[model samples]
Target: MRQKVFNWGRYPQGDVDLLPLYYLEELDELTSKPCIARGNGRCYGDSSLSSQVISTITFDKALIFDKKQGIFKCQSGMQLSDILDIIVPHGWFLPVTPGTKFITVGGAVASDIHGKNHHTEGSFSKHIIEFEIYSGEGLHYTCSAKEHPDLFHATCGGMGLTGIITSVTFQLKKIESVFITRVQEKARNLDEAFELFEKYSNHTYSMAWIDCLKGGNSFGRSIMMAGEHTTLNELNAKQKPEALKLLQGSKLNIPLDLPSFMLSGLSVKSFNELYYHKILGKVKQDKTYFDQFFYPLDAINNWNRMYGKHGFIQYQFVLPLSTSRAGLVEIMEKIRNQGSGSFLAVLKQFGPQDGMLSFPMEGYTLALDFPFRPGLLKFLNKLDELVLKYHGRLYLTKDARMDAEVFKASYPNLGEFINVLDKYVPKRSFSSFQSERLFG
Candidate 1:
C-alpha cells in the first residue's frame, strides 16, 4: 500500500501511477526535491504525474462549518461527495460541480474545473473563498482574492505548479434535495444543436451527449439536457423522504475493468441509438438519482478498460459559439476520416468564463472518447490546428499530449497568468505532467 499506485488514465490505455504520500509531514518533506501532489488520479493524462506525488488523500479532514453562512472549510483531500452527503439534505450544494463528484477539493482548485452550470456559476474557483497552500520554499500560507491575490489567480488553474494545496474553504449552495428537474430535446443535426443551445441559454445547467460517428446533415446530432435542482415543495412528501435517504447511501464502484473491446464502435452505436430514444424526447419528470445524472460512467467500475489495453484518448476543445460548427465539423471530419470513431462524444455551451486562465470560454465545447490506436497523435494535432484556426482552446486537465508552443498559443493570456503564478513562490518550484510536458 505504501508503494506506487497508478490509474487506467480514463483514456483507457496508459498505466501510470503516483508515489503516494499519505500525510502532511510527508508533503512538507517533499518540497526539498521537485514534487507534485495529486488526488484520485482522475486527470486523463500525465497532468498529475511526477516522480514524487504526495497522495494527499490522507490529508482528509473536515475542519469547519457554519450552516447559516453556508461557508465550509476542510482539508485539501476532502471529496466533494463528503460535503454533499451533509449539505444536500440541508438544501445547499457546491455552487459548481464537475461531471463526477469523485474529485478532491484541492484537485478542483488546481484544475479550475467547470461544470454544466458553468454558463451561470463559472468554474470552481469562482466560489472558492480561500485556501491554505504550502509553497516551494517550505513555507505555509493562506491565500484568497484579497490576500496574496496574485497567487490566488495563479493557483486557481495553475495545476498545483506553485504549491501543494493543504486546506480549502468554499461557499456551498443550499439545495432542496439531490434531484434535478431536467428537460430533454433531440436534435437532428449540429445546426439544430446550435438552435437548442441558443434557445435554452438560460438554464442552470445545459449539456449534450453527441453521436460522433454519424455525420453529413446529421453531424453532431445530440440530446440536449437542460436542468436545475428541484425545489423541496415541488416534490411530493414521499419523494422528498426517499431523496434524503438516497444521498446518504454509498454507491458501488466498478471493481474491475472490462475487456477493452466491450465498448467498440458498433456496440457504442447501438447504445447511442437506445440513449437517443430514451432521453431525447419529452420524458416525464421521472425521478432521477444523482449518481446517474451527474456521473453516468461512474456506474461501471473501470469502465474505461472497455476501450481495451491500447487506451483511448479524450479529445476535447472549446470554440466560440460563432465558430463552433465550422470548427466542430472539421474536427469530426478528421476523426471519421482517420477511422477513429469515438465511443462517447459530448457537446455543451460554455457561459462567460470569469477565471483569469479558466478553460471554459463563452462558446461551445465538444469532448470525444475513442479507443487508442496508432496515428492518434497525428489526428489530434490536426484537430488542434482546426481548434486554433477558430481561436478556440483545449482542456489541459484532460490533456496528456499537447506541447507548450501550442499551449501558449491556446492561452495567450498565459503570460499574465504566469505572472500571477510566480508570486505564490518566489523560489519558482512545484511540478505536474503539465509543468514537465507543456510548461517546461
Candidate 2:
C-alpha cells in the first residue's frame, strides 16, 4: 500500500511504499529493494522513515515465554505495552522502558532506549540476550553479546541500519508488585535540582520537569521526582488489589489537531506555573501503580496532535557529568532568552554510554519539546553548537532536524557503526531517510 507517514513528532512528513512482511520468506524478496523496517511508528523522527519502508507491525507474536526464568522470545513487532500487559501480572517487567509504552520490542532494541532508571539499570540493550536479524545479504543471523558480538552491538543501537530485526529473546526483571513508591522534591533552581539528583542517586528511578522560562535566581527551577518499585509487603493489604491491577490502554484522546498558537509562550507559562505548584505541594506519593509512575503521558492518546499540524521536535541531549550542569544551564538560558516556550522540559541523569552508538553517557540529559515554527531549525542549530561545545550528543530517536555534521561530531563511534553496516548491508538494500540524511 502507498501512504503518507509521519513520525510521532509529525514533522518531515513524506510518502512511502509500505511493504508488509508477514513470513520469513518475504525477507528474501525484500533484498532487491531499498528499505528499512518500520515498527509502531512511535519514533519521533525519520529514523524509521524510508521511501521503501518495511512494515513490521504484522510480525508481532510472542514465540516463547518462560515464566520461571522471566525470559521472553517474541517477534519484533510486539509492542512494549502489550508485553507489559502480559508480564506485569506475572511479576515480570522490562529491564528498561522509555516514557511511553507504545514502542515495539524491535524499536526498543533498535533505538537502545533508556529510561528514568538508566542511572542504575542502563538502556534496553543491557537486558537483551539475543536476537535474529535479516541482513542486507538476505541472510538470517543470530546476534548476541557473546555470539556475533560485533553485529550484536551494532544492531542493538543501530537504528535499523544494519538489518531488519526478526525476533528478540531478552531477560525480564522480576517484580513483586506493580506499585511504585514515588518521592517528589521541589528544587528552587537548577543548582538545587542537580544537588537533589546527586543526593538521591541511589534511587531506582529519577527525573525532573524544569520551568525553562525562568531566569537568574529561578532559572531551571524544577520538580524532581524519584521512584522505587514497591514490594508487596510495602503496600497496605487494602491497596494491594488496586496496585496490582493491570493497566488498561488509554481511551482519552485529542480529537483534533490543536492550533499552533494554542501553545504560545503565555499559555505554556501559565500551565508550567500550575504544574510546578501542584508537584511542589506534594512532597511524596506512595503506592502508585507502575503505569502511573512511568507512562503518565500515555494517559492522553495522540498527545502529539496538541503541537498542531506542523508538528513539534523533541530535542534530547546528554552531556558528561563534568560539563552537564554548566552545559544545561547555558542551554536553558539560551532558550529563555530566545523567548521560546517548551512546555515539556525533562531532565534525567544517565549512568554511562554503553551501546556503540547509545545516546546516554555518565551525565545529565535534558529533553525539550519545541513546536515547529519559522527559524526553528536555526534555533536548534544554535542549541547544537552548545551541545557540541560541552561534548554532548543529541538522541537520534528523538531528532528531526540535526545536521549531518552535528550528528557526526556528537556520535564518535559513527565509524565503527558504519564499518559494521558496510560488512552486513548490501548496496541500496537497507536504508532510511535518517541514515541517508546523516551518512548518505
Candidate 3:
C-alpha cells in the first residue's frame, strides 16, 4: 500500500510503497526491489525513505539469549526498549545506546549508533558478534568481524543500502542496578566544559546540554553531566528492594503540533536560561533511573510535534580533536550571530570509531535542533563548509540534505564502502532516497 512515511524528524516525508515483512520467506520476494528496511523510523532523516520500503516492525523476536554469558540473539526488528524489558531484570543492558530506546536493533547497527559512553565503549557494532543479512542480489550471508570483515564493516554504517539485516547477535553489558549515579556540573563557558570533561575522563558516561544562543563571554555555557551505573550498595533504603526494576512507558503525549512561534529565539533563550539554572549549585549529585538518565526525551510521546507540523532538522557534526575548540567557537559564533537558537543542544567527547563509514572519531561532537524554516538549509550548508574546513563531517543518520560533494570529501573511506556494496549488492537493488542523493 502507498502511504506517507517520515523519520523521527518528521521532515522530507513522502509517499512510498510499504511492504511489511512478517516471515523470513517474505524477504525473498522483496529483495528484488529497490528499497530500504524501515525500523522504528527514528533516523531523523531520509536515509530510510524510498519508493519501496520493507517494514521490519513485525519481524521482531528474540531468537536466543544466554543470560549467564550476557549474549543475545534477536531479529533485526526488535527494539531496544523490548530488549531492556527482558534484560534489565537479568542485570543486563545494551553495550551502547543512543538517546532514545525506541529504535530497532537493526537500525542501531545500520547507523553504528554511539552513545554517551562512546569515549569508553565505542559504537553499537563493536559489541556485535555477528549478524545475518539478505543481500540485494538474493544472497544470504552471516557476517562477523572475522568472516567477511569488509562486508561486516560496510554493513554496520551502510545506511541499509548494502542489504536488509535479518538477525543480530551481540554482547550485553552487565549491570548491578537499573539506576545511574549521576553528577551535574555547570560550565560557565566552553573552556570550563572542556576542563570538566577532562577532569571526569574516567567516568563511564559524559555529555552536556549547551546553551547555543548565548554570545560573548556567555557563549557555549553548558551543564555538564557524567554518570555511571549504580551498584546495589549505592541504593538507599527504599530503593534497595527494587534496584533492578524496569522503567514504565511514558504517559505524556504531545497530541498536536505546537505553534511554530513557541520556539522563537526569545522563547528558546528564556528556556535555556531557566534550564541552565535548574541545576542549582555548581555541582549536584543524585541517583536516577536508567530511563531518566539515558532517555529523557522518551518520557514524552509524539514530542516531535513540539517543532510544529513543518518538522525540524537535527544537525549533528564532529570535528577532529585538534581542531574542535576553534571549529566549535566559529560554528557557535555563526549560530549566535544568526540569532537562531537551539533549545536542545548537546555536546559530547568521542574516543574513536571502527566501521569504515561510522560517524564518530577521536573528537568532540555537537548536535542541535533547528526548526525547518526557510533559509535553514542554506545556513546549515555554510556550517558544513566550516566542518569540512576543520576536518569534520556531519552524521549521515541525522542528515536530510547533505550534498554529494561534501559527503564525498568528508568520508575518506567512502571508496572502500562503495567497493563492498558493489561486491555484495552489484545490481544495486537495495537503495534509499538519501543514498541516491548523497552517493549517486
Candidate 4:
C-alpha cells in the first residue's frame, strides 16, 4: 500500500510503498526491488526511508532468554520497551540504550546508538553476540564477531545499507533495582560543565542539559546529571516494590500541531531560564525511576507535534576533546545570533570510537532541536561549515538536510564503508533514499 512515511523528526516526509513482511520467505520477493528495512520509524531522519520500504514490525517476537546467563535472543523488530518490560523485573537491563525505549533492536543496531554511559560501556553494538541478516540478492548469513566478522561490523552501523537484519542475539546487564541514584550539579558555564564531566567521569552515567540561548559569561550554563544504579539493599521497604517497575506514571499527548510561534526565541529563552532555576532548586542527590531519568520526554506522546506542522530538525554533532570547547562555543554563538533557540540542547561526553561507522568518538557531543523556518536550512548549512572546520561530524540518525559533500567530509571512512558495501551486496539491492543521496 502507498503511504506517507517520515523519520522521528517529522521533517522531509515521503510517500512510499510499504511492504509488510510477516515471514522470512517474503524477503525473496522483495529482493528484486530497491528497498530499505524500517522498524518503528524511530530514526530522526531519512536513513530508513526508500521508495520501496519494507516494514519489519510484524516480525516482532521474543525467541529465547537465558535467564541465568542474562542473554536475550529476539527478532529484530521487537521494541526496546518490550524487552525492558520482560527483563527489568527479572533483574536484567539493557547494556546500552538510547534516550528512548520506543526503538527496535534492528534500528539500534543499524544506528549503533550510544547512551549516557558511553564513556565506559561503548555503543549498542558492543553487546551484540550475533544476528541473522539477508541481502536483497536472496543471500542470508548469520554474522558474529567470530563468524562472518566483516559483515557483522559493516552491518552493525551501516544504516540498513548492508542488509536487512532478521534476528539478534545479545547479552544484558544485571541490575539490582530499576531506580537510579541520580545527582545533579549546576554548571556556571561551559568550562565548569566540562570540569564537572571530568569530575564525575567515574560514575556509570552522565549527561548535561545546556541553555543555548545565553551568551557572554553565562554561555553554556547547564545542569549536569550523574547517575549510578541503586542497589536493592539501598532501597527501603516502601521503595522496593516500585524499584522493579519500569514506566510507573501516566503520559501526556500533543493532540494537534501547535502554532509555530509557540517556540519563538522569546518563549524558548523564558523556558530555559525557568528550567535552569528549577533544576537549581532541586536536591543535589535523589533517587528516581530508570524510565524517568532516561526517557523523561517519552512520557509525552506525539511530542514532535509541538514543533508544529512544518516540523523540526534534530542537529547532533561530535568534536574531538582537543577542539570541543572552541567548536561548541562557535556553534552556540551562531545559533544565538540567528535568534534560533534550542530548548532541548543536550551535551554529553563520548568515549573511543568502536563500530566502523559509529557516531561516537573520544570527545563531546551536543544535540539540539530547532523548529523549521524559512531560513533555517540556510542557517544549518552555515553550521555545517563550522562543523567541518573543527574536524567534527554529524550524526546520520538525526540528519535530514545534510548534502553529499558535507557527509563525505564529516565521515572520513566513507570510502571504506562504501567498499565494504560493494564487496558484499554487489547489486546494492538493500538501499535507502539516504543511501542514494550520500553514497550512491
Candidate 5:
C-alpha cells in the first residue's frame, strides 16, 4: 500500500508502496517491482526511500547463536537492540555499533555503518562473516570476502541497491561487563582537540563533542571522551553484582515537535555552553553503563523532533588525515561566518576505508546537525565544494541534497560500485531515490 515514509532525519519524505516481506519465500514474489529494502527506517536520509519499499520489519528472527564463539546469525530485520538484549548478559557485544541501537542488521550492512571505534575496529562489514541476499533476478547468493567478493564489497555499502539482504552471520565482541571506563578531557581549542585525540589514540573508543557555535579563541572547543570496556576486576563493589546488566527501556521522549525558534542560534549556543561546562574539570574519569557511553542519544525517544517539524540534516564527512586540520579550519570559519552553528557536532578519527562505497577512510570525520531552513541547502552546497577541495567526500547514508556532480567528484570508485549494480541489479529492479539522484 502507498503510504508516506520518512527516514530518521525526516527530510525528503515521500509516498511509496510498502510491501511487507514476512517469510523468505516472499523475496521471489517481490521481484516483479523495483523496490528498496526498508528496515527500522533509522537511516538519516533518502538512502532507503523509494517508490516501492520491501518492509523487513516482520522478517526479524534470530536464526543461530553460537554463544561460545561469540557468533550470531539472524534475519535482516533483527534490531541491534534486540541483539544486545540477548547478548550483553552473555558477555558479547556488537563488534561495531553506530550511535543508535534502533537500526537493523540489513541496514547495518547496507550503510556499512561505522562507530566510535572506527579507528580500531573498522565498520560493521568488517565483522560480518557472510550473508544471504536475494538479488533482482530472484536468486539467492551467499556472499563473503572469499565468495562472490565483488558483490560482497558492493553490497556491504551499496545502500540496498544490489539486492535485499535476507540473513546475516557476524562475529561479536566478547566483553567482561556491560560498563565502560571512561575518561573525559577538555580541549580549549581545535588544536588541543586534535592533540588529545592523537594522544589517546590507543583507547578502544574515542569521540569529541565539539562546540561549533563558538568562534575565535574558543573555536572548536570540545570535550574529548575516550573509553574501554570495564573488566570484571575493574568494576566497583556495587557494580560487580550486575556486571553484564542490560540497558533498561528509555523513559525520556520528545512528545511533540519543538518550536523552530527553540533551536535558534542563541538557544543552541546556550545549550552548547552548558554541555561543555558540565564536565566541571580539565580531565575526569568515571565508569558508565555501555549504553550511556556508546548510544547516549538513544536514551531519548523521538529526539529528532527536537529539531522541529521541518526536521534536520546530519552533515557528516571525512578529510584525509594530512588535510583534516586545515580543512576543518576553513569549514568551521565558513559556518561561523554564515551564522549557522550546530550544537550537536561530533568528531571522530577513522582508521581505514573498507568496501567499495563505505564512508570511512584513514582520517578524521565530523558530523553536525543543522535544522532544515531556507538557505541551509545552499550553505551546505558551498561547504560541499570546500570538502571536495580538501579531497573529502560526504557520507552517502547521511546525504540528502548532494548534487550528482559533487558526488561523482568525491567518490572515485563510483564507476566500480555502479558496475556491480549493473551486473546484479536488473534494470530498475532494485534501486532507491538516492541511487537515482546520484547515478542518474
Candidate 6:
C-alpha cells in the first residue's frame, strides 16, 4: 500500500515501492515481465534485489513439501523461518542455514549461502535440486545441475542477475529434535582454537568466536563451539514435545536509525565478553528452541539498530589453508596497530568451495563488523591486496566494498558466470553498492 524501503544495516538507501502481484492471469502476466525477485530483503548487501518496482510478496507461499523424500518445493519468497515453523515439528531442519533465519529460501540459493556444516554440506546449491525462474525475456524456465547445467551454475550465487527465481525445490535434512546439544570450549588463544577445531571437527557442526582486540597468548582469543541435534534419548519427555514449533507471529522494524557513535569497541567488547563467558564450559546438555539454537540474535527486535545510524559494513573473507594462519596474524596485527575497533568478529573453518561463485573455501573464514570510518575504503583496499596475496577472496554477500577488477582477479570464474547470465540479461534492474562496485 505504501512505499517502505529497508536496508539490512540501515545503510544509505532510498525508498522503493514494492508493487503486489499474484499468480492469477493478472499476476501471472505481471510476474512474467522483466523484474528482479525480492525475498525477506536480507541480502546484507544489495545483490538479491533491485530498485525497480517488483511484485514479490504477493506470491508468497509454500507451493509444495514432500516429507516422504525430504524435499521442499516452495515459493521463492518464503522465509527460512517460515519453513522452520512447520519443518521442526516434523523432525526436519535446514541442512545449511546462515547466521539469521530471516533470510528466504530463494535468497539462500541466489547467494548460495553456506552455514556451520559448510565443511560437510557445502552450500544451498548442493541441497537445491531445481528451480523455476522468470528471466528478462518474460518467460519462466527450469534449471539444475543435471538439466540446464550452465544456467544452474551461473544462477547459484548469481545475485539474482540471471533471472527471477519463482520457486525452488531442495532437499531437507532429517533431525531428531529441534534442540542442539552444544559444547562451548573456551580457547585462551588462537592456537588453542586451531587445535580445538582440528580436534573436534569430526563432530556435526563447528564454529568459533574471536576477540579481535586481544593479542599475544590472548591474541585471537576465542571460544570454539560445536553441536548436533539431540536424539530422543538425549531429550527428556519434557524436552521433546510432539508439536513444539517455532513461532513467528510477530515482526518489528527500526523506526529510524541512530548515530554511528552508538556502536564502539568498548560497548561491542563488553557485549562479546558477556556472550563468550555465558556460554563457556562443557554446556554438555544445554537445550534451546530451534530459533534460539540457530538464530539467537534474532530475538532482539531491530537488532541492526545497535550498529547506529551511519550503518556498519561486514568485512568477511577466506584465506586458503596455506596462508590462513599467517594471513590472519597479519590482519589482526594491522587492526590492532590501527586501533580499529571491531564490533563483532566470527571465525569459521571452511571445508571446500562448491558453487561457481560461492565464497567459502578449504581454509579459515572470518567476518568482522566495523562502523564506516573516514578512510574505511582505503583500509579495506589494503586488506583486499593482502587477501589476494594470500590466495584468498572476499564474500560478496556481506561486502559493501571491493572493486570489480579485484573481484575478477580473485574469482577466475567471473567470466563464465557472466556468460551464463548473458542468456537472460536484465536491462532495467537495480543493484547494491557492492554489486555496482564489483560488476557495474
> What are the per-residue Cα lDDT tens digits for candidate 4 across 231-315?
9889999988877776668999999999988998889999998889986563399988899989988999988889998889999
Off by over 4 Å in 6: 1-6, 15-17, 24-35, 53-55, 240-259, 279-285, 426-433
User: Which lDDT tens digits does candidate 2 get at residues 252-296?
Assistant: 899889997889999989989888888536376666778888999
Q: TM per model? A: 0.92, 0.97, 0.99, 0.98, 0.98, 0.91
Q: Output the lDDT of residue 414, model 4.
A: 71
Enumerate clash totals for all models, in the order shown. 15, 0, 0, 0, 0, 2
For lDDT, candidate 5 versus 6, the one ahead is 5
**Which candidate tops lDDT?**
3
lDDT accuracy of residue 285 in candidate 3: 97
For candidate 6, write residues 151-199 as lDDT tens digits.
Answer: 8888888777776677889999998876777777888888888988897
Tell me the whole-model lDDT of each prediction, alpha carbons only. 0.77, 0.88, 0.93, 0.89, 0.91, 0.74
Candidate 1 residues 1-440, lDDT tens each?
Answer: 23444443554232333455556676656667677778877777777766667777777888888888899998998888787777766667888888877788999998899888888878888898999898866578788989987778878887888788999999988777778887788888888888988887898888988888786787778888888777778789788675555543444555555675676667877887787778534433454656667777766656666666566677789998788778888877777666567665889888877555668898988988756667777778878888999999989888878878788898866887777666666555677656777877
Off by over 4 Å in 3: none
- Candidate 4: stretches off by over 4 Å: 281-283
Question: What residue runs in model 1 are displaced by over 4 Å at the alpha carbon?
Answer: 1-5, 8-26, 241-243, 247-257, 280-285
lDDT of 5 at 423: 78
C-alpha RMSD of each candidate structure in angstroms: 2.5, 1.3, 0.9, 1.2, 1.0, 2.9
Which pairs clash in the backbone of model 4?
none
Candidate 1 achieves a global lDDT of: 0.77
lDDT of model 5 at position 184: 98
Model 2 per-residue lDDT at 232: 76
List, residue by residue over 1-440, the lDDT tens digit for candidate 5: 78999998999898999888899887878768788999999988899889999989889999999999999999999999999999999999999999999999999999999998999889999999999999966688999999999999999988998899999999999999998999999999999999999988999999999988788899999999999999989977987888988767556999999999888789888999899999998999999898899888998999999988899999999999999999999998898788667776999999988688898989999999988999999999999999999999999999998999999998888789888877777485887899889988
